[model samples]
Target: MNLPPVNIENIDIKLRFGNFVLNVLYVKFGYFLSSMPEHSHSQGSYELHYIPQGKGTLIAQDQSYPITPGTLFMTGPDIIHEQIPDFNDPMAEYCIFFEVLPGDSTPAINRNHIANDRLMSELLMSTPFWIGTDRENMMALFEMLASELSIQSVGFHHTVTNILEIIVIRLVRQYSLHTSSLHPVPLKTLDDSRLLTIENCFLYQYPSITLKKLADNLRLSTRQTERAVRKQYGISFSEKKAQVRMSAASRLLLSTELSIYAIAVQIGYTSQEQFSNAFKRYYGMTATQYKFKRI
Candidate 1:
């Protein structure tokens, strides 16, 4: 699909630990049928490339990496890179160019938070080049961005900004996984975005997720984590977790033919009996009854 290029001059993007202002130079989506000449970004600039289909080769500073469907890579400041698509199966790509800038002001609540952001920024800046496959399944996000830009519906700009921010965060996460030394430190304050990330853990990682795991992910103490969840969601952590799991379970029951035991396991319940009891308490109907009633 043809997507109009998006140019964002200056916008603040919230990261896991802190925020950064960025200029999104452009976003492009197309099947690269022609080779791109070797180019390097200016200082503080990065170009992210995602290939959703076909094959290509990326040559970065004399090193070549095979690019296939689901390939993702980034060329940062001063990294020479060239793209050559295979003629037999030209690669479709989603490319984003942006320059990261320092935030206007850093909060004074915790020096550690600032340090964490700095550490992440430094990591990104120091790594001039990286090539890897997409682990976050960002094709859907790129498609959504393209759709929003093409349609230009009400609030499209806001939606586009949010999607771009998420793309940046997921990119950072990919880098963090490779750099074992990088770690999240406890923050003195939790912002709404960070709180939402914490809440989404229950949605995405409900199975085998724990309070300690959530606390560690936030780099906060368990008590502080619980307080944050309650403060933002107006409910206890367990209640919120149940709400997410039950909602998911209900969908599974209605949408799929999975057995109750399987659905219970999928949603982190130890047994069908336990899941049934919880579902009944939450929805006033047994698992089977709910399924049949909906049917």
Candidate 2:
């Protein structure tokens, strides 16, 4: 049987998302499911990884970073890297692979250059990595991007690209803020027209969303909205919402110290008992048990 759909709606917003062109290669998140040895990306391909929880090690070009909660790392196309998840404490991270389009804004430079004339070019030239202090915001974006790709909803290709653009821009901003460099990366330029309308809706409203409420927010009839969603993901609207909520709950359970009841309410359930039943149905274990298993 086909699985339930992931929630990945987009909406319009006036943020300076990005100016550089980008093409997404792949996006995914979960436990350590692979045992690939050291590998390198194809030409022009780059990788962005976010480790929301657990501990491990990331080795790139012989440079290593301790993978911990809230760690974000970006690697150039030529860098050789190996992901070593702690065997007993395996990590869960969101990874996106893509390539930046050649353009006038990105200076032509050798991949080995640690510094470049332009800030954007320098970012691409060097291996940019960060362990962020506030992870909730970043994890939410990763969750949404993963949702879009996991479902492969209609128009999801474009939606995934849009979200990745935002992620790249955010990283650039972080790099600029911390690095002491001669060139400053432009932070307010944009090139794509895909708005964050539906994405914002799910990000902010997923906790307590109803089909009718969701339809009204998007300004479409309930039936029309349901049809559109079904056409895109092959699942009912309610199923999609539950999937999103459960996904978020799983993340919070692994990363935060919140109590079961608090997490239940945070994800929009009225009571811990209700959330526990639903969680058990979706994950085949209780929330407390799931948390302990990861510990």
Candidate 3:
């Protein structure tokens, strides 16, 4: 009855992982379940969309990005966008739009001019974004949001806001992790604390990383550094670095509509072909195939 009250386990999991609580204040419905015409977010309210089935192309601002099942797309007050679904495949999505005042900590509105203002153009060029997630974690977040919104009782807004805030923060972390790896490093590590700190930095910033540099930062020999990671993760440092880079690469291909070239640069590959080859070897599929698969 009542669709079994949705799934509350998802709510608990999301809450446990993110420590984010939100209340939805309002919602605007869409008319086209089978088709979405050209549209835009030119005002203050924002929209969060999650696709569960099918593939499509979304034109956000002036740039177009492909979309697929499990895709999450968010737009803020400053942008305009349209949805172009792949009719060949069935599409299922959960989306909602709402507003927050100035100073609100919302990703859709809290970005810099380059991002919030012209993200479409930036996305078109090669600026990387991130959203591919650990499946359990991602599912928990989305299911919780959907459950919170399904409520017809009182005081829903506050709960939805808390959820949205938490989700947006996680998305921001994803973006920071993916982008920083492509960016630069600020300092070197010299101790255990510093090493952990450096590791966190690499994870967040996506710095070009190496064992030699890590050992130099920590004043250890390269072999010592390799031994440490091997001892802890049961994998060689080389394997670990490759694993992390691959993880980031997979995220870029999925969460973003970035081209193979753009995604390559973000994940430390110097060229698109190199990235494609490595991705195929590791994932057993080309980046494009992998991206469309929604794994």
Candidate 4:
């Protein structure tokens, strides 16, 4: 995969590729003045964010969500989102952007339009589409991310990459199990094989996703899916998804240096308050409190 043209604009977005056949890039995770305005890159590259401290909101097109400590977000390329701070305390987060190319015999993930930009949308498909996190673990992950970012050692790329995979699988299992409250769809409807297929695609990128394209891909109604998932799992779908998303986010926060706002956008939230409200509802303490307690 072609990395964005090298420039100071992305100097911190460490890119590691070439003879290693690697395409991994990461953003700083903590303590810096956010110099860039709220805009987005048009390049189609997969991205993930982990928030460890402070408060911020993510703005995307017409949507907004919060980015608080212990929040982890992952989305495909062309997702136009920007970070918004809470204006209270220092902001901290860590993020990674990567591309997965197809391999032998396995149908290759589409690369023809990998660069097309539209902005990642969590609203395309129906309920149980796979996305979620928890509150307590989310905070723990956030602290871990901050520590890792502070070290910033050589070959950190390898370490970061491995961590990223673990985050991905945690996310996959969470969402695959309908553990996200941000996705709108309830967790009650995730039992069918179809829901699993959709989430697998989102995580593994097994099938190419069209830009802002989600229609007729699901076989359940919002109510039906929610009901079914709850019946099967014995918990509301939204709660489960949020629990999962929050947990993954915590992991990211504990491991990266990306700012809080960036991490908010990487997750599905559009602003900081939104993220905070959701987080507090789940964890009781504020993002700031969680950060301090961890230290």
Candidate 5:
């Protein structure tokens, strides 16, 4: 019997941002047969599979679930799983592999007193094994990844890393919303009314995101929005945003070979000198210093 290849080195990327680093192993959109044998992913790795168009049964941890379009499954660490594609029918899907460490934002995690501190820390560790997603949103993200991977163009990996972060945010949002309906108080802590939604928008559009855009989305005055951020996070909106950008910059410095100038442009800084100053203020070291030290 022919077995699917598991060459992780070819596609794997050491993706990093903030306090998070993801070892993205592989992604494929194709047919996978199950006649071979059951297998578990390596320790410290994760596998996310999305069935965009298919009929199959996913057997994991001795439980079986039917797979259909928009079905997304997540497995972290060592968990036995195997896919059984329908014998006679075509099974098409997208599978992603990666490993995340301490899946929390940089300083937010350091501030353990914050409301969502536990929530963000537990995001990847506590992900559900399988989930049903909004078909359109899920498929759009998968397709975008597929398109980028197919092209392997300039900055494709960067694009993929950004989209992967967005995907994680969406998953967390859905999970939190669902859990909130069952238990309201935790959601209230993680989200201050509609403010969490706004925060997620910032995460999705960071670096280039503008306060005016967030205010427009919420139909709130800029001052009102700023007030909400301070109320929720205990910091001004600009400070929080700079933290996010610097987090991204630091990750780029350590993980990628990009120059300080390129990293600055990617994170919305206009000049390398300006970005370098911010880096020093946030990290207490020059970007070049950080990069070489990490090396």
Candidate 6:
């Protein structure tokens, strides 16, 4: 069967936990029709697994965990693990390999206030292995990652990296929920400055930015992100995105010698015709007319 791309490697994400940088070594997604040989990660590394479909068994450290659809687990730092897919219904897997290494110190104020990065790092490292069903419905995010990477649209790299960060946060949240030592915290609303930062994403990443991506960046839920946007800008996310794109289009048309098609592609339109239609709707004139009239 045709699968979304697999064996995605060497992705750089600027997600930090205290002085440690979270490095994504690779990501893989496929169905396991056969058994996987026992494997172990090196020191300071983790392999996060999510099973979106089928049944299987994960053997780790001589313990067996029944893997079902929505199972999310992590094997960390030298933990030997293997997977055995059910022949009747083979397991489909999404795996992310990552490492955390010491880096620059964190700033005094933690803007993404779900938890301090130091605490997050401590919690993640403290657990050597975990197996449980996903409560956050993270399959959607994984699917989004697969789609974005496959399409490689404008700002796709940024979207994928942001989604990875959100996955990390969700993983932390799931861990905190089950652990007795810590509890999950509600995400705080973005302040005006932070909201402005999100607005800047709309300005720069107009081609590929979505409300979901913006929410992931802010570490807030999509609904919360929408509310925050409305509160801060007095406009919806789509409206703001369109405004930014059209404004940029107007400037490029006036200042640059690029053709209409080039301007459309640069501003995120898939086709010149599509861009022309949107330009007319926004400006009430054809792009060529606007350019000649203004010039």
Winner by TM-score: 6
lDDT minimum window of 10 residues, candidate 2: 186-195
Worst 10 residues of 3 by lDDT: 12-21
Model 1 ranges with Cα > 4 A deviation: 1-19, 108-116, 176-295
Model 2 Cα lDDT, one tens digit per residue, 29-115: 666644334444433445677877777888766577788878887765445566778877778877665545434444445643323
Model 2, residue 60: distance off in Å is 2.2
lDDT of each residue in 180-263, candidate 6, tens digit only? 212222132444235345634864577778899889888888898888766544568787777767866776787579999999
lDDT per model vs. reference: 0.71, 0.60, 0.51, 0.44, 0.63, 0.75
- The segments of candidate 4 whose C-alpha lies over 4 angstroms from its true place after superposition are 1-22, 32-36, 105-159, 176-295
| Segments of candidate 5 deviating more than 4 angstroms | 1-18, 33-36, 102-118, 134-136, 176-295
Global Cα lDDT for candidate 5:
0.63
Displacement of the residue 242 alpha carbon in candidate 5, Å: 52
- What is the TM-score of each predicted model, taking all chains together? 0.54, 0.45, 0.38, 0.39, 0.50, 0.57
Q: Is candidate 3 or candidate 6 better by TM-score?
A: 6
Q: Residues 174-232, candidate 1: write the lDDT tens digits.
A: 87433322222223245434544563475467677788888988888999888876654
- The RMSD of every model to the true structure, in order and in angstroms, is 18.7, 16.7, 19.1, 17.9, 18.2, 19.6
Tell me the TM-score of model 2: 0.45
Give me the displacement of residue 285 in model 5, in angstroms. 63
Residue 208's lDDT within candidate 4 is 31
Kindly report which residue stretches of model 3 are placed more than 4 angstroms away from their true locations once superposed. Answer: 1-32, 103-136, 151-161, 177-295
lDDT of 3 by residue, 1-295 (tens): 0122232211211111111122222332222245453333212234566666577777665577877766776654334355666767645555544332223333353446435434322331122223342333454666666666677357655675566656655554444332221222112223324334334434544437777777776677888877655543446777766766776676567667888898888778788888789889888888888888966
The local lDDT score (0 to 100) that residue 116 gets in candidate 5 is: 55
Candidate 4 vs. true structure, TM-score: 0.39
The regions of model 6 sitting more than 4 angstroms off are 110-115, 176-295
Candidate 4 least-lDDT 10 residues: 1-10
Model 6: how far residue 120 lies from native, Å: 0.7
